[model samples]
Target chain A: MPLISQQQKAVILMADDDADDRYLVQVAFEENDIQCELLFVEDGSEVFDFLMGQGKHEEKGSKIPNLILLDLNMPKKDGKQVLQEIKALPAYHHIPVVIFTTSKSPEDVRQLYKMGASSFISKPSSFDKLSEVVRNIGTYWVETTMLP
Target chain B: MRKQTLQFLYASLAAAVLLLLSIGVFTFRSLRSLIEQSDAIAHTNKVLFQTEEVISTMKDAEIGQRGFILTHDSSFLKPYVDATQYLGRQLKLVDSLTNFRPQVVQRQRVRRLFYFAQQRDAHIKQLLAASLEPNRPDYDLRLIALLNRGKATMDSARIVVDSLQQTEKLLLEERIHHKDQLSANTLGLFTLISLLAVLMFSLAFYLLIQEIRRRQNYERQLEKTVSDLLRTNQDLEQFTYVVSHHLQEPLRKLQTFSTRLVQKHAIELGDNARFLMERMGSTANQMQTLMADLLVYTGLGLHGDTTDFEVQDLAVVFQKTVENHEKQLSAAKAMVQFDKQSWPVLGEMEQLELLFSHLLQNSLKFVVENQRPHISVHTFVITGEQMPFATQSQHDERFVKIVFTDNGIGIDMQYQDKVFGLFQRLHTADNYPGTGVGLAVCKRIVKRHNGYIHLAATEVGAAFHIYLPLAN
Candidate 1:
C-alpha cells in the first residue's frame, strides 16, 4: 500500500467530456485553498489511459493519481464503465474514485457507490458552493482519511 | 369488481345447470309413470273383453246341444262340441288373466261361472245320449227335462259370468280413471318443470347481462385511468428532460461568471459588491439543487417497468445510504443504529438505497438545536391488514415493515399530511437546509416499489414507517 505523505501534494485525475464544466471545476479548485495537482481528461477512455500510463499519459511517467474524480455522462465511454473497470483491477482498486457529476439523481449516486465509487458529489451550479464542496472534499479525503 | 362479477356469474350458471338437470329427471320420471299407468288400463280392458267372451261361448254351446236334441242331427253336436272346446279355452284364459289381480270378488265370481258352465255341459251331454238310445221309451220327456235343467244351469252360469263381467268392467273403469289422473299429473309436472326452468333461465340471463354491463363499466374506467397515466408520464418526461439539460446549463454559467467576476475584480468592486456576488452564487446553488430535485421527482414518474427489480438485502442498501450521507451524518454528529439481521425485500436496489438516504437526510437535517441526531432503523414483518392505509386489493400478503425513527424536531400532526407533498416545507431555509423534496422523493420511490410510506405521529421526534413486500 502506497501512503500519501502530509508534505506531498496529492494528484486528482478528473474525466469529463464537458469543457465548460471542466473549466468551472478548475476555477473552483483554484478559488479553494486546497494544495493538490489537478489532471484533466476529456473522455472516460482517457481516464483509463491515464490510470494505465498509456497514450499521452505514458510520457508523464509512472505517476498514479491519489484520487479520481469521474463524470457520469462522458463521450466515447461513460463514468459507470470506467468505475467498473477501475474497481475490477487489483492494482487500481484501492485508489479512491469519487463521482463528481452534474447529476443529483439519487439513483445515480447509489449506483455509483454500489459500483465501488468512494464518494458521489453533485456539481453545484454556483462557483462559491463549488469551491466549498471542493474544499470539503480535500479536507475529508486528503486530510482526514488515510489514503492508500 | 371484476372478480365479484365473475363469482356471481359462476354461481348463477351452476344454479341454472342444477335446475335444468332436476327438471330433466323429473319430466322423465313423470312420463314413464304415465306410460305404465296407460298399460295397466289396457290390461284391465282386455280382461273385461275376455270375461264377456266366456259367457257368450257357454250360451252358444248350450244352444247347440238343444238343437241336437230336437233334430237328432250329429252336425248340431259338432257345433256343440266345438263351442264347448272354445268355451273351455276361453274360461282358462279368463282364469289366468284374473289370477294376477288381488280382487277376491273377481276370483270368486270366476270360480262360480266355471262350476255352472261344467253343469250346463253335463246336462247337454245327458240329453244327447238319451235321444241317441232308441230303446228308451220316455226319451222325449227325458230330453225335455234335461233341456230345462240345462237351461237353468245355463242361466246360472250366465248370471255368474255377468257378475264377473261387471267386476271386470268396474276394474276397467277404475283403471281408466287412474290412467287419466296419471296423465293429468304428468302433464302438470311437465308444465311446472318448464315454468321453473324458464324462471331459472331468465334469472341466469338477467344476472349474466348485469355482469356484462359491470365489466364494460370497469373496462371504461380502466381505459380512462390508463390514458390519464400516459399523459402524466409524458408531461413528466418532458419536464425532466428540460430541467436536466436546458435549465441547469444556464444556471451553471451564471454561477461560473459570478465567481469569475468576484475573483478578478474583488478590489475594483465595493465591499457590498462581494456580498452581492456571494448572494448570487448561493441563490444559483439553491436553484440548481431545486432543479436537480425536481428532475429526480419527475424521473420517478417513469416507473412503468418493474422487471429490473430483484431480491435485495436491506442491510446492504442501508449501508449504501449511510455512506451516501456520510458527510452530513458526520457534520451533524448523528448516530444511526441499524439492525444486524438483514431483511430481504423485493425492490430495485438503487431506488431502495435512495429512499433510505432521503429519510436519513431528513433525520439529519431536522435536528433540534445543539443536539446530536439519533436515527434508528429497525424492521419487522407484518400483514397487509395491519397497515392502516393499505389498499384492499394489494397483491402482497405480507410486507417487511421498516421503521425509521429519529431524535429530531418532530413534525406537527397538522403538517404530517402535507410533508410528502412536493416542495412542501414546515420550516424556513434558515431553520433547515433542504430542497423540501426529500420526503416527496422517498414517497415516490416507495410507490414505485409498490410499497407504503407515511410519517407516524410522534411527540418527541419524527418517525417514518415504510412497508415493502417481502421476497418469496
Candidate 2:
C-alpha cells in the first residue's frame, strides 16, 4: 500500500528498435532527475530474453521488472507479439505494459489498448517534451498506481 | 448528352406506339365495314335468284296448260298440277327474300306478280276442264277465251317481275359501288399507315442506336474515372504512410539531438552555435508538425473502409471533442454555446470528432486579442433540394447542417477561397501559430462523411456551415 519513494529504486524496462530513441529516453530520465532505475532493450527479442531468461540468458528466476515500455516496430518479433505473449502468460500478466512508439495513429492506439496496454504514449520530438512525458509517466505509474 | 438521348428515345417510342395503336383500331373498323358490305351483296344476289325462280315457276304452269289444250292428254295435265303446287311456295320465297324496308318497290311488284300468276293458274284450270268435255259445242269458245286471258295475265306478270329484277339490279350496283369506295379508302389508309410505321420505325431505330452509343461512351468514361480515382487514392495512401512514418523519424532525431546538446552542454556552447542549434531544433519541430498535419489531411480521405461508419450524434461528438479541449479552452477563456445538441448524423465517429476538433481549434486559434472567444453551434434539418449548393438529386434526402459561429477574427472576403486550401496560411507564423492544414483536414473529413463544410458569409465573425447525412 505504500507509494514508491525516490530513494527506493524501481526497475523500468524499455524496448525500442531505434538506438537513438532508447538513448534519448535514457537521457530524458537522467535530465529530469528521476531516480527510477531505467533499463533498455534494443528490440523485441531482447525484451523477451531479459524477461523469460531464455536463449543467451542462462539464469533462471530473474527479477521481474515493475513495468515494461514497448515499441511497435522491431526486428524478429513486434511489440504486438510481445504484448500478446506477456498478457497471455499468467506469470507476467500482472506487470503493467505501456506502449511507447512514434506511431500516434488512432488505429494503433485503439488496437494496443484493446490488447491490454496499460498506457499508450507517442514519442515526442524534443528532449524537453520527452522529459516532461518521462516525468509524468514516472509520477503516475510509479508513484500513484499500486503494483501487483 | 445521355439525358437528351434518353428523352429522345422515350419520345420516339411513344410516337411509334401511338401510331401502331391507331393503325390497329382503324384497320379493325375498315375490315368490319368491308365484311358487312360483302354480306349485303350476297343478300342481294339471293333476292335476284329467288325472283327469277318465281318467274320460271309461272312460265312452267302456263306451258303445261297450253300442252294439255293441244293434245288433250292427262299426262300433260300432271305438269300443270305440279306447277300450281310449287307456284304459291315460290311466290312466298320471293316475298320473304324482298321483305327489307329498302325493297318496298320490289315488294309491291312481287305482290302484283303473285296476283297475276294466280289468275293465270285459274284460267289454266278452266282450260283443263274444257279439254275434258270435247263433245260440247261451247267448249271451244270457252277454251279460246280462257287462253287469251291467261296470255294477258302471264305478260303482265313477266313485266312486273322484270321491273322488280331491274330495281334489284340497281341496288346491287349501288352496293358494289359503295364497297369499291370503302375499299379505296381503306387502301389509302393502309398505305398511309404503313408509310408512317416505316418512318416511325426508322426514327426509333436511330434513337436506339444513339442511346446505345451514348451509354457506351458514358460507361467507358465512368470506368476511366473510377480507375483514376483508385490510382490517386492508392498514391495518396502511400504518400501519407511514408511521410508519417519514414519522414518523421529523422526529424524526431534532429529535434532530440539539438535539445540534448543544449541540455547536456549549456555552458560550453557559443552564442551563435546555441542560436543555430535552437533554430535547427525549432525548424525540426516545425517540420514534424507539418508532416503530422499533412498525414492527417491526406489520411482522412483514405479511409475507404465504409464498414466503419455508424450513426453518430454530432452533438455527442462535439461534446466529447470540447471535453478533450477543456484545458485549452479554459486556458484561452473560450466559450462554446450550442443551440442544438441532439444533431444525429451518419459518419465514422472518430472522424466526426476530428472534424469538430479541428474547427474548435480553429476558433480558438483565430481569436482576436483582448477578447474572450464565443462560439455558437446550431443545427437544422433540411432536404437535399434546400441545400444551398447543388448535390445529388435525391430531393427527399435529408441533411443535418451544423452552423458554427465564432466571435473570432473572421477571414477576409478576398482570402475566402484560399482559406480551406492545404498548406495555405493567411497570417504569418509570428502572428498566428498554425500549420494551415486544419481546415483542409476538416474539408476532407466532411467529404469522407458524404457531407460538405462551406464558409458562410458573415458580417461580424466567422461562420461555418457543416452539412452531414442525417441519420434516421
Candidate 3:
C-alpha cells in the first residue's frame, strides 16, 4: 500500500441533483471512515458550468470535480445529455462518470454502461444498504481502480 | 378449388360427349354404306335367280312338248300346260322387275313367239287327225312354214332379251358407281366431323387445365402473402423488444445518481442544494416510470396464452385494485365508493387489475391537502344502439359505461392531453411525487380492452368516463 496524498484525495468529484441523497452519501462516507470529498450539482447544466469554471461556480481556486455522479432525469439538463457533452468535450473527457439512480430498469443499466459510465448503482432503499454501496464504490474508485 | 374441379368435370363430360357423338356418326355412316351395298348385291342376286328360273321353266315346257310328240302321254301335256301358266306369270314378273325400254321390247317379242308355237301345235294336230288321203297330205308344208315363223320369232325374242340384259347390266354399273360416290362422300364428312370434335374437346380440356393451374397459383400467392405478413409481425415484435431494452439502460443510471446524492450530502447541503436534490429525485423517479410505461406500451399488442375468457364480474377486478391501493387510500383518508353488484365484463384479469389500479391511484394521489377524498366506481350496461363504438369510437350504438369519479384537485382542461403523455406532470415536484405515466398506462390498457376513457364534467373534483364495447 502507498501513502495517500491531499491532492489525490481531492481528485474525485460527484455531480448530483438531489440534496438528501448527497447528504446520505456523505453520511455513508463518514460511517465508512473514508476521507474523500464529494461535490454536487443541481442538474447537468450546472455541472457543465462548474466544469468550465463559469456561471455561479466561477471563482478563484475553485477546483473542478474529478468524477461526476450523474442523475439521468433532471429539468434543465439530464444526466444522459450531461454524460454525452462531458464525453464529447476534450477538456473534461478524461473525467470518469458513475451513474447513481433509483431505477431498476435493465435498459438504463445497459445504456449508461454503453455511454462509458464507470459504474451504475441503484438508490439504496435502506440506510444500511446505502452505507454498503458507498463503501464498495469508495474501494473501487480509490484503491482498486487507477486514476486519469 | 371446388369451383375449378367442377369446371374440369364439366369439360371432361363435354369431351366425352363429343367423342361419343363423333364415333356414333362414323358408325352410322359406315353401317349405312354397308346396308346400301348389301341391298345392291341382294337385288343383283335376285335378278339372276329370277332369270335362271324363267330359263328353267322354258326348258321344262320344251321337254313336255318333246315328250308329248314322242310318247303322246297326257302327263307330259299336263307339265307343258303348268309350264305355260308359270311362263306367263314369270313374263309379267320380269316386266315389272325391268324398267329399261329394251326389256319391254324383249317381252313383246316373247309374246309373239308364244303365239307362233301355239299355231305350230294346231297344224300338227290337224295333220294327225287327217285320213290317209291326198287332201290332207301336205300338212308338212304348213308345219314347215309354222316352224320357220316360230324359229324367227324365237331368234328375235332372244336378241331382245340379250339387249335387255345388256341394258340391265349398264343400269347396275351406274347404280354401283353412284353408291360408291355417296359412300365416299359420307365417310369423308364423318371423318371431318370426328376430327373437328376431337380438336374442340382437346382445346377445351387444355384451357380448363390451364385455368385450374392459374387458380392454384393464386391460392399459393395468397398463402405466401399471409406468411409474409406473419413474418413482418414477428419482426415488429423483435424491434419492440430491442428498443425497450436499449432505451431503459440510461434511465436507470439517472435514478441511481439522484438517490446516491440524497443519501450522502443532504445534511451538509444548503436549502438550494436540498431543493435541487429533491428535484433530481423527482426527475429520476419520473424517468423510471417512463421507462416502465414504455415497456408496457411496446408490449401492448402481445397476446399471451389465450384460454376461455368469459365475461367476469367487474366488481372483482375493482375490489382487487382498491385493495392494492389501500395504503395510499388510508394515507389520504379517501372514501372510495363502489357498486358491489357483480358487473360482468370480458377482460383479462391481470390487465384489468392494472388498469383499475392506475385510475384509482390517480384519484387517491390528487386529493386536496388535508381534505378527505371521495371516489366513486360504478358500471352500467347500455343498449339500443347507444354503444361505445357508435357514440364514442365509431359513432355506432350499443355500449357499456364505467364511471369513475373523484373529489380531488381537478386537472385543467388545457393539460388533459399532456396528462396522458409518458412522464407528463401537471404539478410541481414537491406537491406531487409521481412520474405522471399512470394515466398513460391506464389509457393503453383501456384501449386494449376495446374501450375509451374521457374526462367527464366534474362540479368540485375530477370525473373520468369510460366506455367499453358490449358483447352479444
Candidate 4:
C-alpha cells in the first residue's frame, strides 16, 4: 500500500466553492486516520493555478496532486470544464478526478461518468457519512491502488 | 378576419341565388314564347285543313250534281243537299279562324274561295232543277255548258285554297325556327349558370376549409404553449429541490456543531448550556426533517420515471409497509390482518409501499389512549360509477377498491377532505411528531396510478377507501 511506504507521501487536492465544505473534508480526511497531504482550493480555476505552480503556488516545494476531488458547482469555471481540461492535458491526464457534488441527479451521475470521471459521489448530509465516504476514497486511492 | 370571411361567404351565396333566379325567369320566358309559337303553328294548320276541306266538299257537291244530271235519280241529289249546308258552315269557320292579324292574307283568300264555292253550288243546283223539268230549249248544250261552268268555278276555289295553305305552311316553319332558336339560347344560359353555381360553392367550401385549418393551427399553438408552461413548471420544481437542499446546509452545520459542543465540552459547559445545546440540536433535526419531507413532496415523479410499474399484489405491498414499521409495530404489538381475498393491483411497487406505509404510520400516530393499533385490509371489486374520482385511464373500467380500517381516532367527516392537503394536520407537532405531508404524498401517488384515495366515514376507527383501476 502507498501509505505503508515510509519514505513517500500521497497528495490529494480538493476544489470546492464553499469554504466550510473544504474545511469539513479536511477534518473528515483526518478523522479516518489515513495519512495523506490534503490540499484545498476555493474554485476550479485555482485548481489549475495550483497544478501549474503559478501565482501564490509558485514556490519551490510545490507538489503535483496524485488525486483531485472536484466540486461541480463553482464560479468562473465549473468542475466539468476543469475535468475536461485535466483529461485533455498530457501532464495531468493520468491523475484520477473524483466528482464530489451536492447534486443527486441521475443525469449528473451518468454524464460525469461519461466525461472521464473516475468516480461520482453525492455529498452526504451528515458528518459521519462524510467521514465514511472520505475514508473509502482515501483508502482506495492512496493506500489500496497502485500508481505510476 | 373570420367575420370578413363569413361575410364574403354570405355574399357569394346571395349572388348564386340571384343568378339561379335570373336563369329561372329567363327559362320561363323562353318556354312561354315557345308555347305561343306552338299555338301559332296549330292555328296555321287549322287554316290549311279548312281550306282543303272546302275544296273537297265542292268536289263532292259536283259529283252529286253529275249523278243527278245523268240518271235523274232524286235520291242521288241527297249528297248535293247535304253539301250545301256543310260547306256553308265550313266557310264560316274558315273565315273566323283566319280573321286574326297574323293571318290577314289567308283571310282575304278564304273570302275569294267562298265566293267561287257559292257560284259552283248555284250552277250545280240550276242544272239539277233544269234536268228535273219536262222539256227545255237546247237542253243537252245547256247541261254541258252548266257543267263546264261548275268545273271552272271549282278550279278557281282550288287555286285560292292552295295559295292559302302555302302561306300557312310558311308561317308554321317560321314559328318553329323561332322556337328552336329560343330553346337553344335557354340551354346555353342554363349550362353557364350551372357552371357558375358550381364555382361559387367550391369557393365557399375552400373558405370554410381555410378557416378550419387556421383554427387547427391555433389549437396546436395553444397546445404547444401549455406544454411549454408544464416544462417550465417542472424546471421550477427541480430548482426548488436544489434550493431547499442548499438551505438545509446551514441547518446541518448547526446540528453538527451543537452535538459536538455537547459531546466534547460537557464539563466546561454547565448543565444549562448542555441542555440548550441539546435543544438546539433537536430543533435543527426537526427542521432538517421538515425540509427533507418538503423535498420529497416537491420531487415525487418529477423525473416521470414510472417505467418500473408492474402488476404487484396489494397484500405484499401492505406487508412490506408493515415491515417498514416493524419496530413500532412490535413495541405496540399492533394487530395487522389482511383479507384472504387476493388483491392484484397495478402500480410502481415502491410508491405503493410508501403509500401504504404512510397510511399505517398515520393510523399508528393518531391513536386513542391505551388502544392497541389494529389494522384490517379488505378488498372488493367495484365499477367506475361507484368510485367518485373515476377517470378514463389506459385501463379497464373495473376497479379494485381496497378498504384499510384501523382502530385509531377516526377523522371528522368535515376534516376528511382537508387532511389530504399539504401541511394539513389535525394535531400539533407535540402530539404527533410529523411534517404533515403523508396524506398529500399518498394522494399524489394514487393520482399517478390513475386511482383515487378518500377517507370513508366509519363508526369505529378510521377507514381509508382506495380505488385502483384494473387492467385486463
Q: lDDT for every model?
A: 0.82, 0.84, 0.69, 0.83
Q: What digit string (tens of lDDT, one per residue) describes model 1 on residues B363-397?
A: 87778899889999889989888987888876447
TM-score for all predictions?
A: 0.60, 0.70, 0.48, 0.67
In model 4, residue pairs whose N, Cα or C atoms come closer than 3 Å (at least 3 residues apart or on different chains), thus clashing, are none
Tell me, by lDDT, which candidate is best: 2
Question: Which of candidates 2 and 3 reaches a greater TM-score?
Answer: 2
Q: How accurate is chain B of model 4, given as a TM-score from 0 to 1?
A: 0.71
Q: Output the lDDT of residue B241, model 2.
A: 69
- Residue B152, model 4: lDDT of 86
| Rank order (by TM-score, best first) | 2, 4, 1, 3
A79-146: candidate 3 lDDT, tens digit per residue: 88888888888888778888887665566788888988888877665566778888887787766666
What would the per-residue lDDT of candidate 2 be over residues A1-148, giving only the tens digit for each residue? 3277666678899988888888888877887776578887788888878887776565643557899999888888999999999999899998899999888889888999999999999888878889899999878877787765
In model 3, the runs with Cα more than 4 Å from the true position are: A1-148, B1-41, B48-52, B74-164, B185-218, B262-287, B297-472
lDDT by residue for model 4 (B71-190), tens: 988888888888888999999999888776565676679879878987987888788877876477788788888878888888888888888888878888988898788888878988
DockQ of candidate 1 compared with the true complex: 0.36
- Per-residue alpha-carbon lDDT of candidate 2 for residues B1-472, written as tens digits (9 for 90 to 100): 6688778778877887888898999999999999999998998888788878877888887777778778876687676778788888888888887776475777788889878987887777777888888899888888888788888998898899888888878989999999999999999998898788778878889989877787899999999999999999789787776767778877888888888898779889978889988888888878888988877777676777766788887778888899999999999988889864687787888888888898899999988889999999999888888886646575678988889989899988777668889999999999989899988888888878878788888987899998887888
